[model samples]
Every structure is written in structure tokens, then in C-alpha cells.
Target: MDPYLLNAPWVNTLRLVLEVAATVAFALSGVMAAARKRLDAVGVCVVAFVAAFGGGTLRDLLLDQRPFFWIRHTEFVWGILALCIGAMLFMRQRHFEPTERAMLLPDAIGLGLFAAVGVDIATAIGMPPIISVMMGVTTGVFGGVLRDVLCNEVPQAFSDHRPYALCAFAGGWADVALRQVQAPDWAPLVACVVLTAGLRGLAVWRNWELPAWRV
Candidate 1:
């Protein structure tokens, strides 16, 4: 039996917690975007649902996992619905305007958390380290991509180029390295989350950007 599988119970718990956190953060991001676009209630819910589950759905499909996470945990759907309703009500009451800059923090947080979860899942499934890292990047950025595309904007992962996927790649490798060294299972997850989020935050704060290619 794989040691990763042996540590399943606790690891699974951590995964669940991380998944919820990621889902909420991404959902908020989507809601903010929808609000900025002046979308109606139903549109807000649609965007929130896609942002919350898009990446995980793609990840599970690639891994051949049945009954995608959101499907298995139907409560997540209700949670997102409640969250959207509450957030909209609050924003309207306060006359709050959702700005692009305001969306960065939650989006970054979700990216980090989902990246860590992706690496964890792929590792547990006995994927190679490189593949696990790729999975991490994919899980981190895919939802944001879907959200942006739906909003008719270029995805941040493609256009912003402020070390988004690069951060996830680095963090995923860190997680894999820690696991290889017999670190506690939770350590890798925590470390990766911090690294990915911290890097993303720093990138935003410092106006970091990949050099643009000119024709």
C-alpha cells in the first residue's frame, strides 16, 4: 500500500477543508466579477458555480475520478447558493462597487489552496512529480480562466503573466519535495498554500509582471 494512501484519513480531511476554502474564495471572486458587470441574480449564481467547481471538475475528469467533488458533496452547491445570496444582499445594502483590484486577494487565496489540493490529490493517486505539479497549476488557474472567459476577458493566467502558474508550479514542487523527505502530510499542504498565496500577493503588491513579448 502506498504511504500516501496509508495517510488517507487525515489527508482526506485536510483536502476537504482546503476544498471548501478554495471554493468559497473562488465563489466570492466570481460574485465580485458578476457584480462589477451588473449581472442579474441568476447570472451571478451561474458565474459563482462555474468559478467554484470548474477546476475541480476538470481535475477529476483528468484523473478519472467518478462523481466529481461538487457532485459528491451536494452541500457545496447549496453553500455557494447561500453565499451568493448573502453577498449580493450585503453589497446592495452598502452600495458597494466591486472593483478588479478588490478581487485579487480572494482570487490569489483560492489559487493557492486549490493548487495545494491538486498536488495532494495527484500525489495520492501515484502520479509522477512533474505531472502532479502540472495538475497543481491546472487546478489553480483553470477556474479563473473559465470565469474570465465567461466574462469576455482574457484569463489572468494568460494575460497578466505575473507568475500565476509559475507560483503554483514552484509550490507544487515544494510539496513533492517535502513529501519525499518524510515530512508530515499536512506540512506540504500548508507550505504549498503559503508559498503560492504569498507569491501571488507579492506579485500584485509589487506590480510584478512577466516581460511582454513584442513582435
Candidate 2:
């Protein structure tokens, strides 16, 4: 089966849909972070843009795609810019708070989407399974890692509290295994998204963590 279902007449349509879903979720999360930092308009745009493009850009770079998604998907860039503006205006009206809580959902969703796509794209280019897995994990977590650095917070994925990257890594490997099973293309995609989202949700709900790194 073709890795992309919409590699059909509706390919562009599906791409637009996936791109928008990931873009909006990531843009909002980044905007929320910038709001907490009391960033100005430019800072808000920068943060939102980085968050929105971070995962995809990293995926493209690793895949050796020149120009990146943001370059080709100019509308995606504009959409995040608009969203950042709106979110900043809205934050001005309410007492917006920054909690680890807000980032969880978007991060999880983005992780699933990015991870699945990373594998698909890598596989399309004939990358080995292990490389695809690495690309998937990198595409999933590197954004939030960069986001934390920008926000001056210790990266949550690398820390004990949430273990977000660990969840993503497990899911990406699961995704690769699923594909190698030759079940269906959708099998890997569905499994990747479900496993990542489910694990992230569990971590958030139960406050799960890896055992404390040695004292």
C-alpha cells in the first residue's frame, strides 16, 4: 500500500488538512508560552513560528529536503502568524497562566503527527527503518525542546516530571515495527498517533515519570 493514502487526487487536500491541524495546535501552545513570558509582538511571532515550524523543519532537514515545509507551505506560516496575533490579543483580556498543563495536549498531538510523517517521509526516501525511527523521535520532541530553551525553562522531555520524549521514542519505534508488519500503511500511522497520544495523556494524568536519575 502507498504510504500516503491521499497520494490520490486529493493529495494536496490531505496535506493541507494535516498541516493545518498540526500548525494550529503548535501555534497556540507556543503563543501561550510567549504570553507567559510577556513577550512583545515580534517575540510572540518568533516563538509561534518556531513552535509551528520546528518539528516539520527538523524533519525536512534530516530528510535532506531543501527549502523545508514552511518555504513551500507559505500559507502555513501566515496562519500561525495570524494565530499568534489573535492569541496575544486574547491573552491581554484574561489572566493567562503558564502551566505544564497547556503544552501537553498540543505537544502530544504534534508528536503523533510529526512522528508518523517523519517515518512516512523517511521511508519514502528509502531511509532505513532505524533512521526513520530516529527522525520520528527528533521531529516529535525537538520542537518542545527548543521551545523550553527559548522560554528559559528546563526542557520537560529531558526532565523527570513528564518524560515526554521517552513516550515519543517508544511510540516511534512502535510505529516502525507496525510498518514492518506489512499490515497496512494506515496501521503504522494510526498506531503511531494512538500510542504517542495515549502515552502522553497517561503521563499527564498520572504524573508519571522515569525513576529519578541517580541521586
Candidate 3:
């Protein structure tokens, strides 16, 4: 039973659209980041792939979706490749930007979409609500975290005062509550996407951060 289809079909179509936009943004950001790092053509693509798909890969594994979403969506792979090549060929090659300001927008989009999709898959697999929410957050952050580690830096999302992953968690769990109420399936998905993107953008704009432990 396509559990995520509880909403009207139009909602599903909207989600599919949002998901694609998010994926493309993520791919572009990842590809751009790799290029800025001065990675060779091959390294540029490998890093891009890891940054874009790592979270989804982990989420699918946890959900027991063998073969993974990227494997199933082979065009997604081709799209990533096309993006990498285009970025390399056309974009100005620059030294890696540590602050990485441009990445903020795309990363937020990626966070929202991945979190929503994670919730959908988890609910489909009959996982407990809380676990599903955690998976949602994981789906949003793991990719960038791993990408940062590979690039030999602590993830900006974690090291900074900004509420990066926190936003993802909030967005993910929001859907869980909605799921319990049996509200339109797309409500949570749309809510999470808007919330995650807005929260992250607000945090960046306002310099918002979690309260630090006063030792």
C-alpha cells in the first residue's frame, strides 16, 4: 500500500517536484564544492556523488531498501554527472571557500527534501514513529557530514552555533505528529520542507544558535 499516497494525488505531484528541485540544488552545490576544492575531474565527481547521495543511501539501507534509491533512479546518477561536468567546464574555478556562503541555500533545500523523503520511507517500512523521525534527520545531514569529513574538516553544520541539524530534527518530527493525526500526508511533507528551509535560512540571517552549556 503506497502509504505516502494518503494525500490527494496533486500533493504527491508537488512533493515529487520539490524533491527534484532539492536534489538538483544539492547536486549543484556538491559539484561546485568539489570543484572549488581543486579536486581533479574524477575527484570532483566522486566527492559530489558522496555529498548528494550519502544520506539517502544510509536511509535506504536502514529501511532495508536494498539497491538504494540512486540505484533505482539511474537518471539521478546521470544528472549528477552532467551537473559535475557542467560546473567544471563553465563555473569559475576557485579555491575552496571555508565559509562557503553559497552552499547555505542549496544545503537547506537538500535538508528539507531529504528529511521529508526519509519520513515517507520510514513510515512505509512500518518503523516506529520516533525512529522514523530520527531516520529523517539522518537522511538530511549524513551526506554533508561525511562530505566534510572527507574534505578534512568538521562539518560546518555541527561545529557552528547555528541550529543546522536541529532544524532538520524539528522538521522531521513535525511530520510524525501529523502522521499520527492522519492528516493529509502531504501536509507534513510540505510543512517539513518549508520549516527546514525557513529555519535554516532564519538561523543564518539572525545568527541564531542553541544555548551553549555554561560551564
| Candidate number achieving the greatest TM-score relative to the actual structure | 1
How many residue pairs clash (N, CA or C atoms closer than 3 angstroms) in each of the candidate models, in the order given? Answer: 0, 0, 0
lDDT of 1 by residue, 1-215 (tens): 35765567976887898899889988988898788778899989988898888887888889987888888899999999999999999997898877778777877778889999888889879999998988898898888788888888888679876888888888888988998998866788898999998998898899888998997
Q: Number of clashes in model 2?
A: 0
Q: Rank the models by lDDT, top first.
A: 1, 3, 2
> Compared with the true structure, what per-residue lDDT tens digits does model 3 show for residues 175-209?
88887887765678888888988898999899997
Please, what is the TM-score per model? 0.91, 0.88, 0.87
- RMSD in order of candidates: 2.0, 2.3, 2.8
Better of 2 and 3 by lDDT: 3
Which segments of candidate 3 are over 4 A away from where they belong? Answer: 1-12, 92-99, 212-215
Candidate 2 Cα errors over 4 Å, as ranges: 1-6, 9-16
- lDDT for every model? 0.86, 0.75, 0.78
lDDT of 2: 0.75
| Residue 211 accuracy (lDDT) in model 3 | 82
Query: Per-residue alpha-carbon lDDT of model 2 for 30-121, expressed as tens digits?
Result: 77777777888987888788877787788887678888888886887777877877777777788767676666787687778777777767
